[model samples]
Target: MINNAPEVLRYAAFTTDPAGGNPAGVVLDATGLDAAAQLAIAAGLGYSETAFLTPGPTERSFAVRYFSPLAEVPFCGHATVATAVALADRIGPGELLFQTGAGPVPVSVTAGPDALEATLTSVEPHVLPIPQADVAEALTLLGWAAADLDPSLPARIAYAGARHLVLAAATRERLADLAYDFDGLARFMTDRDLTTLQLVWRESVGVFHVRNPFPVGGVVEDPATGAAAAAFGAYLRTLGETTPDAVLTLHQGHDLGRPGRLRVELRAGDARVRVTGAAVAIPADVA
Candidate 1:
């Protein structure tokens, strides 16, 4: 168990179709791989992120780590979802707890006739205001002007497991056409310890479209971002954009030709946001 992991599995989260969602590599039994080996494996897969799991006292619990293409992240929502569903496929769906660097995350998986779905409850979420200067600088990197931002949503840094700047576009067109200065944005994010910019546009009362620029992860863009979705839900709840108890739907990756959907739920008394979606394994041939 030193160098050789039991198996390396590839799965896509937030969508039932492997071709639609964000892809992640999962090692269900990574009992011996160290941080360097984990980083190498994640980089080799070339996905935005990958997860490694070490068994805990019981089969229902494990210590998990997430590695992006460049570095180790405290947590990753999509990867967590993928791992839970992958485990469910073998052990049958129920509950699984993952001890992550950020905190403990509890995931519930349910097996259905069509696919396996997983819902992950995030840690307590909070929001903080983004400095006007910082927001302006970010906008400049994105090639967007102040007028392009939706005045109603405002701007803030939201965090559930990771931090993301919540910026709302005035229109869907603005959100769809994403071409940013990658290096500049990367520098800005790294300085602020930001994971991705949650560039979003509200389509209606409960539906929204989003795009995430994950330069820090060494990816141009994330087709589907579950962590951002959870953060955005907390942002909305904080801003009174949505009711404290509401279900919101997010559509992502369509602009990249890989469409994925995520469901976000907020409870009245609970501060933790629940992000739910289905994950499917990418066939070996497709990989």
Candidate 2:
């Protein structure tokens, strides 16, 4: 075992129940922990991602870094939400700024009916058209055909704090069946610096069922993805799919047996997207 490991707290983001959301390891005080140590802890924990927090320049702010099992990531939404809730539980609900690799992220935490809800405002988000050849390759690796895609949403690469391939499914059934070539997809994503594939199926106006294939993170899938949700919101905005000011509901992780809900908000004139979700601490033994 590693010597003097930093205390790693466990929390589940985007769900009130411990077993109903994405779990993330949170190092509340990683002042002296180096990248190797953080990566070790994250790898040992085997969560999709872990968050390391160090004091920032000002009060109520922290310099946070995220690590997957294999490598460090610029940003991770679920881990951010987990860290924010963990901090709120100790410091009381309020606003906190996170200095992340992607950029400075502002988060607000408030007590919800059942759990603490944290809202993270993403950096200015943008979308880019993915090459047809790349999309075709991705479809082949995913065992999906061109007809499986939803022409309304179109395929694009979206960036909020991290890059994600946004692909909408023509039907909920297509989105539900998510057996993809892990190794092939991982290689594909690594070459393109993609964090996850935001596979979605629109349920109704401003409501969607989403799933994230996160092979690049060394995880097969992410139960609740905040970054991808933010990216998806931006994608919708760029496509003129929703009103300037709109609230979207995303249902994710249900197929994985860890159902979670994310609330995505877009404001008029603001290029940033806001994602809100509840998080709860996981008991040590349970975690």
TM per prediction: 0.97, 0.99
lDDT of 2 by residue, 165-203 (tens): 999999999999999999999999999999999999999
Clashing residue pairs, backbone N/CA/C < 3 A, model 2? none
Count of residue pairs whose backbone atoms collide, per candidate: 0, 0
Q: Assess candidate 2 and give its TM-score to the true structure.
A: 0.99
Candidate 1 per-residue lDDT, tens place, 228-274, comes to 89999999999999997999999999999888899999999999999
Q: Which portions of model 2 miss their true places by more than 4 Å?
A: none
The residue-level lDDT of candidate 2 at 7 comes to 87
Which runs in model 1 stand beyond 4 Å of their true positions?
A: 1-6
Q: What overall lDDT goes with each candidate model? A: 0.92, 0.96
Which candidate achieves the best TM-score against the true structure?
2
RMSD of each: 1.4, 0.8
